[model samples]
Target: MMISALPPGLPHPPQETERLKSAAEQLETSFLAQMLKSAGVGEMPEGFGGGIGEEQFASFLRREQAREMAQVGGIGLAQSLFEAMRERHDV
Candidate 1:
């Protein structure tokens, strides 16, 4: 997360914009993960499924999937969020 100041003639550093985009994407990922949870995305069926370990780790799997989805242009939420935040970033 180190952001060094750009040399004299250079415009705003791309790093800051990249950081903001990453943050927005992560936010989208979290939102998708929550929605998936509410939709029983990773829910194990029956009482004798993969046991407690599977239950505990299913969330991690769902979140990873959500992150990948966001990275691959999912639902357009991340892009919209990034554009709005970028306005504030340039302010």
Candidate 2:
């Protein structure tokens, strides 16, 4: 006999629903962060810059900005992702 993790015909609990939503939002944030990084949104100046520490933390700034954007329903990608995932998993 095999033990199933989700089992059949059982809907996910509220925490699981929240997890799916969070996952979708995270994906959107990650995509936006990458785009911002590629666009040099946080790039330091050639001179008179914050130097190495700023370089290390620049990505964090982009990520937080991206998270804020996603929270504001950025590009509507997160909502679409959440719906698709919920439907696919029969949640």
Candidate 3:
């Protein structure tokens, strides 16, 4: 009599739901952090240019939001940024 072999189950992989939840959590955290930073609720180290005020914090938040939006979904923001910078300096 011949017997069939069962597949190995040693490699446990995360479920799709788990992965989605983790990704959502990360995005939420990033969004909140960006919001707080822009609102000036966070701290700024010494000798870091201007002081951490409402205006500065708000500006930071805006930039962060834009960056995050551009970053998600594999849009290649990093590559685009690099190309932009490279265009400025040909050397």
Candidate 4:
């Protein structure tokens, strides 16, 4: 959530722009996490420490992984979202 300072004389984005960017990134993360979950990327194999607890917490791991992936430019969804919002808002 650390936004870099805009260069001097550049117009700063409104507060709503920051909120939109954050929301867009979060949406992308959620989408990616769900996709990873659907693909069973982190499911523990049977008899390999797999259990109800693991199952219960699998989504959490997937979410964290997805967040990292998004941060590292996974699928470019966040960038696309940000660009689209910027255009829509003329910011």
Q: Per-residue lDDT for 27-62 in model 4, tens only?
A: 889999999999998898777976778887998999
The order by descending lDDT is 2, 1, 4, 3
Q: What value does the lDDT take at residue 22 in candidate 3?
A: 49
Any idea how many clashes model 3 has? 1
Residues 51-87 of candidate 1 have per-residue lDDT tens digits of 8899779999999989999999979999999988766
What tens-digit string does per-residue lDDT give for candidate 3 at 1-91?
4322224433223453344344454455455556656666545555565654755775666666645654563344344444443333332
83 in model 2: Cα distance from truth in Å? 1.1
lDDT scores in order: 0.84, 0.87, 0.48, 0.81
What pairs collide in candidate 1? Answer: none
When 1 and 4 are scored with lDDT, the better candidate is 1
Model 2 stretches astray by more than 4 angstroms: 1-12
Cα deviation at 18, candidate 2, in Å, is 0.9
Candidate 1 yields a Cα-based lDDT of 0.84
15-86, model 2: which lDDT tens digit per residue?
A: 878988999999999999999999999897788689789987998899999999999998899999998987
Kindly report the root-mean-square deviation of model 2 from the true structure over all alpha carbons. Answer: 3.6
As a whole number from 0 to 100, the lDDT of residue 27 in candidate 4 is 82
As for TM-score, the candidate ahead, 2 or 3, is 2
TM-score of each: 0.80, 0.79, 0.33, 0.72
Worst 10 residues of 3 by lDDT: 3-12
Stretches of model 1 off by over 4 angstroms after superposition: 1-11
Q: Each model's RMSD to truth, in Å?
A: 3.9, 3.6, 15.2, 6.0
The CA lDDT at 85 in model 2 is 81
